[model samples]
Target chain A: MVAKELVLKAELRKKLGSKHSAKVRQSGKIPAVVYGHGQEPEMLSLDEHDFVEGLHHGHRLFDVQFEGKTEKLLVKDIQYDHLGKKIIHTDLIRVDLTERVEVEAPLIFKGTPAGSHEGGLLEEHLDHLEIECTVTEIPEAIDVSVKHLGIGDSIHARDIKLPDGIKLITDPDALLISCRLPAVTAAAPAEEAAEEGEEPTSPEVITERKPKEGEEESEK
Target chain B: MALMPKRVKYRKSQRGKMRGNATRTNYVAFGEFGLQSLETKWVTGRQIEAGRVAASHFLERVGRVYIRIFPHKSITKKPLETRMGKGKAEVEQWVACVRPGTVMFEIGGVAENVAKRALARVAHKMPVKCRFVSRRHTIG
Candidate 1:
């Protein structure tokens, strides 16, 4: 489904720097920067509540209104607090609706892999794939069915069947997901030993010792 | 009784920062569920063992648990009543330097709820705050 264009009222930010940004945040607004299409970057601020609500609407493209002009923009990046509990900053890029843009579309696995039921682990190697498509053609996410995946089976980027007009930009041979046995007991020892750069000798080997003959004889 | 190096290249070493991404081993990359730290702190080997025991006991050994960080850095301390100026102290314990957003542990081959509950128990044993993160929630 095509995401509906969200319209947000923003104000041009005059002051800059971490202190000013902190003040903006304290006032319940988020500091943001908008740039793209060969235009100079614009410092802006938006209502924190509205921006977050817009994100929940699943719309990446927005029509930001400020200074008597409406600019079509895409939500390029969002920086969150270390705890990922709050948004700290945002980056928006202007884009033409008709022009193709490169973005990372999240991959959604649709079903449980057959290997998982048989004690094999299903691992998603890549969570998103880089794709090029027009703003209107951008998919909220790409679904990958894993019901048929068995142990040792893998799905590569090239193997995915994309929607019409969506072109994959990631390496065709890049692994997306795979079904395999858990590496718990099998690979951990070697990997750990290699990382430590030596065999992790047992502590008992260093601490334990046989009593000397003199002590043993005296005890007897 | 606990995990530790049988021998160390040095008795004590400097406590370093836990900077950058977890790129050393596949430990952080492959787990289906994880406990991501929200604060930076030194995690002692005993604390890690307690976490491991909590998680494994809670899961009943139905799945695998991966410890992403190891207490490789040895901290030193002086004995009680010891005077200063005797050079550095003896090795006290080993600790792993953890940073905010570091994946402390991961679990695989278990149901989402089971992993969450198990990790919650593990979190109780840790010195820092943590949250449960799953592969699905992390991919995008």
Candidate 2:
């Protein structure tokens, strides 16, 4: 569940497309679309700073105020710029507080694994977990303990312990994290030695090679 | 040794134009943090090796460094003081054509600050401007 209800005021957007979106962004607002519940999609423009700040604060459900009415909306998707740094557009879906929704929650791996002391490296394979639960019961982040991990030990999605009322939606066999020793690169020298023993051959030329001066008479 | 393809169908390749932002392999897929390029250029294998060594040395082998780019395009060069009437020069080196928005290197199994510093050291070895990025820390 969210700590508090974050309310945002939005203005209805009439114009659309890349040009207008760029203009809206230049004016410090983000263009967003709201649709769900078999209703007509409404184009809206939100305060860029408030929207981005809310996302950074991990706000999933938002109470958007538009046209003198308030609607509960869930962040469906966010389109980023080419650099994947700035948010270009946002998609929101209508939702109720009582219905269940599937969301990708961030996974926080806590505790240093005992394997690290034995010259083992801890690697994180997955950072987020897909989960389903009521909108009001959504968790901010899931914490996975790694204190028991030893060398050659790994934790998969099925091994995670979820909070009450939350159901895991990701595949059970997906690997999340693992601890292993560093790989030794001894084969590099051997590969190079083998390559040196092979005869150098010219690559295929699109145009046939011309005959050498001594081979011209023989070819004729 | 630098990252390169063991074998290739062709040795020398045409110098194609580098235009537009990278559409594939632009996001952080494997690791927690990544080094993103801001310009388009050829990243040589030697430079890639240098960056890998830099990051690995800085981390003291505690974490893993994943090189996302491989030098596949072979570059050819003529010998010094050679005549102009000869055929094409031999393959001199290999490079990876890097466009803007490409995640060149990624570091995993380390703290965020450590990853940022390691990527920063790697940025010094790259030919283009680079920035550190992480898994999109956003809720759905």
Candidate 3:
């Protein structure tokens, strides 16, 4: 459980101006959108470093404190930049603590399986499953033990253990994890055969080039 | 897209007999109960009265609740109430009253997903669409 803290922000709502947001971004603060639950989405800016830290510790649930008030927000979506270095945008859902909320939780594999040691490939049919659960009781990750999984065994969504307040929103029979024989390719051996057929009788020629002096590019 | 194509059928015959076994409510407490009102809109008591009446009917069958409604904002050129005037189907906005605990949201003769339908039905006869919540989507 995480406690809510107020984020004192000076950037109040103002009329649109010429690339004012771009100018604000230059100041190192990132803008974010928060909405859902019958509320008008609002634009809120946060300190870049602080915002990243809050998201990094996203376990069950956290609050987004803006202005002088704090609201319980479930991290609905997070966007990333091209280089995947910066968090571009974040979507927050106002959650009712007791009311059941639908969330897609990650599936985590635990305990090495007998199939894994035998070189069987592990494949996951789904990355996440939607579950209807109380916000407070949301699991960090649903775990499935692969210790006894055979080469052809699979784990389904419904098989995952859920908390009392949680309901599996995914199809009951949908596959969650699968153990399978490793994929074998014929291309490598065929390439070796082709190389034997087309043997290079003579030594191959090689070439190297060196730039002349005074060809270096200048940097500003 | 995450939704599977397979139908999650809730057969009526099974539910009928199953209801007897579910005589005892199996719902756990939903934390310390509380309510937070987002907004409210005033409507003419004439046609919109049925929505409240129907909602209250289900509420009595269930328990205490909270309700909220706001004007539906539009960003499109074509408006919905062009053929008929605003009085026909006001469709002001979506309204909801969450019980928080075990909300068995059911509607119509059949127990189809009545959450969205229940809201739409409110404005059909009246100018209101009310949501009825119990414990779960499908009751025993």
Candidate 4:
């Protein structure tokens, strides 16, 4: 189900650039831009606390109250700091309540796979999948149950049961998760060396050893 | 043994600079929790191995630990008593040049608290500062 609609108060930003953005963040607001429908992108600032709270609560659609008008906006992208800790910037796009759009939906694998209990390693190859759905039908996340998976069993994108009105856009053959036996540990290195037809020795040593005189005489 | 390229085009490489944040493979992709680098540095092969051991030991073989970075760049060193070398030093070790925002290690098939503690043990073995990151939440 789509998240609850959140209304955030915003103001038009006049000063632009890294300097201004730093100041905006210092003032407890996130620098953002809104653009869509071939309209000029407008710079704006949003309350950081409110924006972060909305995100934590899984709210993607927001009604931005700006200059005596409200605009329906969808979060298109968010740029985090170098440490991936703080939000540095955000991109919002205009959208209607009924408009259909494509967006990435995070896939949550629920329940431990039965294969795992059988000594199989559970690996998730994809964390999210591309999906197309109406603005109001966007879900917080797609839940996939792995409880029934057994050894050598896997789930592909096509196997997922998406929510009503939601269509999967990712490659149908893409592997999302799998349960497999753990790799053999012992003798793996030796087997690899035998495959390569090389003596078991460190590859870092580049110097060649000279043959001993006794060995040369014996060969002769 | 720690991960190293079976063969490299060059035996030794210069200490290149790490600039800006990682542009690719920066998010938690393959696992539920990840250890993200907060600074740029050359993570040595030994360090990678140590971190892996640390995390795996902490998890007690209950989960899988994935090493995202490989030590492909070979670093060289000169003898301690040697004066100015006539040529570059010999190959000593290998390292992976990690930039900020890079997810160097990931832990999966574990509980949130377990994953956090496991990755914390890994961070203790890493040279760069690290933080725990989860899969980013998004909606269509």
Top TM-score model: 2
User: In order, what are the TM-scores of chain A for the candidates?
Assistant: 0.83, 0.85, 0.74, 0.84
Q: Model 4: what is its DockQ? A: 0.35
lDDT of 2 at A120: 89
Better of 2 and 3 by DockQ: 2
| Model 4 clashing-pair count | 0
Evaluated on CA atoms against the true complex, candidate 3 attains a DockQ of: 0.01
Interface RMSD of each candidate, angstroms, one decimal: 8.3, 4.6, 27.8, 5.3
Off by over 4 Å in 3: A1-24, A189-193, A196-220, B1-140
Candidate 1 structure quality by residue, lDDT tens digits, A1-220? 6555988999999999999999999999999999999989999998899988877767788899999999998888887765455788999999998989888888877888898788777766788899999988877788899899999999999999998899999999999888887654543454466567884443333444669999999999
Better of 3 and 4 by lDDT: 4
TM-score of each: 0.81, 0.87, 0.49, 0.84
User: Could you tell which candidate, 2 or 3, scores higher by lDDT?
Assistant: 2
**Best lDDT goes to which candidate?**
2
Q: For candidate 2, write residues A1-220 as lDDT tens digits.
A: 4563589999998888889978989999999999999999999999999988887787888899999999999998998876898888999999999989999988889999999889888988888999999888878888899999999999999999888899999999999999999886443464475568853344455455667988988878
Q: Can you give the lDDT of residue B85 in candidate 1?
A: 82
The value of fnat for model 1 is 0.19
Give the TM-score comparing model 1 with the true structure, all chains together. 0.81
Q: What is the lDDT of residue A104 in candidate 4?
A: 94
On DockQ, who's better, 2 or 4? 2
